[model samples]
Target: MNTYYYYDDKFLLTLYAYLKQTESSIVRGLSDKWEPASIYLEKHSLTHKLIDTLNSNKINPNEKFDNIFYKAYLRVKGKQFITSNEADNIYILLKAINEAIYYKKPQIYILGFLRKEIIKTSNKIRTRISCKKRKLLADNVEHYNQHYNGKFYTIEQIVNGL
Candidate 1:
């Protein structure tokens, strides 16, 4: 079986810790949702398209983070959790999740510290469900990850990516 890796609460904490250690105000700001990565992307890439897209689309980079990350995680794990209502509005989080997943390797190094946390959450969830229930839950997660939630591109591809 292919294992999936995605950012979760642990990743968040790791990112937070690193930001604290390095005193990198920029990453800190992005983590707090006060400022967005798009700003940095815009500056470095010299393409204001993401910025313009954010402005035009009114994307709130700082949405319900738990829901956003959960949705991303479920998708990668071949599960789903978000309702259609929720997915429709979380463009910023979706963008971030996609960027994070697509550019693995050193890029994901930025998120490494959260590995322990992510593993904890993952194992906890897996353990809480009995075999039958876990199977059902996994199936449902995959369903939501695919159909109801539009956040995931391809269930198979996302699972592979993970």
Candidate 2:
């Protein structure tokens, strides 16, 4: 099956920095700076509203600022899947990355991260669906164990590679 992977703002920023060959210190600083903002956003109930506003036209005109806010917004919201708007934003970023003048690390690193996320999300959905189909029969138990156990093992390998 085709799976969709969501890249939150933080991951996108990190990927952007990585692609741009940004200094590790600056990347670390970005992560450190986001922590408190994330905490404050979580403590208050404004994460969703903030995300909505960031995606709105008023903010969208300034792509750089919009991306920054989007990263902060994702750091706060902490959801695994991207909304449709977020997906569109990410697509734009990916295109920008592709057209950049300089070549650094292969883009596969970002693709690898995307693959890992897709695997994680698919495993979660599989678990939920299997749980609903679970039955008392030994055959059902065997099927459940076999399917999910194998899936998790593959997920573990992918995560470790990531």
Candidate 3:
């Protein structure tokens, strides 16, 4: 049950940056001033008008995503620090976000936007934590959802609640 099995060094370093830079929730950590979630929420779409157009309805992220964020959120609620378990959970959520992006239709650019936030925020985090990535997200969305049974929230729906 070691969380070290899940996250790789790059993610850990970025997560370290995430802890130092942000004083708020993981949701904010995942957003961008360039590609804000609020704009997507207001527009009720997932893709930028400049890029290929897609709606949020086609991109339903699993509820398990919320669980991962909640765990990461708890770790950083007060102190700008992270435990091994906390780090693992945050990394898992990032993997799940990648999975969520893959599972949804037309490929979500926003999730990539969020992923970039991790590395971007971690610019100051020059420290490193190395580990082997022993696992990946479940093979498919249905299997992953059945195993995790996370609450169902589409991209736009998730914006307000989480």
lDDT of the candidates, in the order given: 0.32, 0.32, 0.32
User: TM per model?
Assistant: 0.22, 0.22, 0.22
Superposed model 2: Cα runs more than 4 Å off: 1-78, 101-158
Could you tell me the TM-score of candidate 2?
Answer: 0.22
* Each prediction's number of clashing residue pairs: 6, 0, 2
Question: How do the residues 116-138 of candidate 1 rate in per-residue lDDT, one tens digit apiece?
Answer: 33333334333322233223323
lDDT by residue (tens digit), candidate 3, 60-90: 3323334666546534442223335544444
Q: For residues 1-162, what per-residue lDDT tens digits would candidate 2 score against the true structure? A: 322234333333222222222122113323454344223323322223323433553334434434656645544654333445444554454443332212333354453453344334323323222112121111121111123443222211222232
The predictions' CA RMSDs to the true structure, in order, are 16.7, 18.9, 17.3
Steric clash count of candidate 2: 0
**Cα deviation of 45, candidate 3, in Å:** 27
Cα deviation in Å at residue 91, candidate 2? 0.5
**Candidate 1: worst-modelled 10 consecutive residues by lDDT:** 137-146
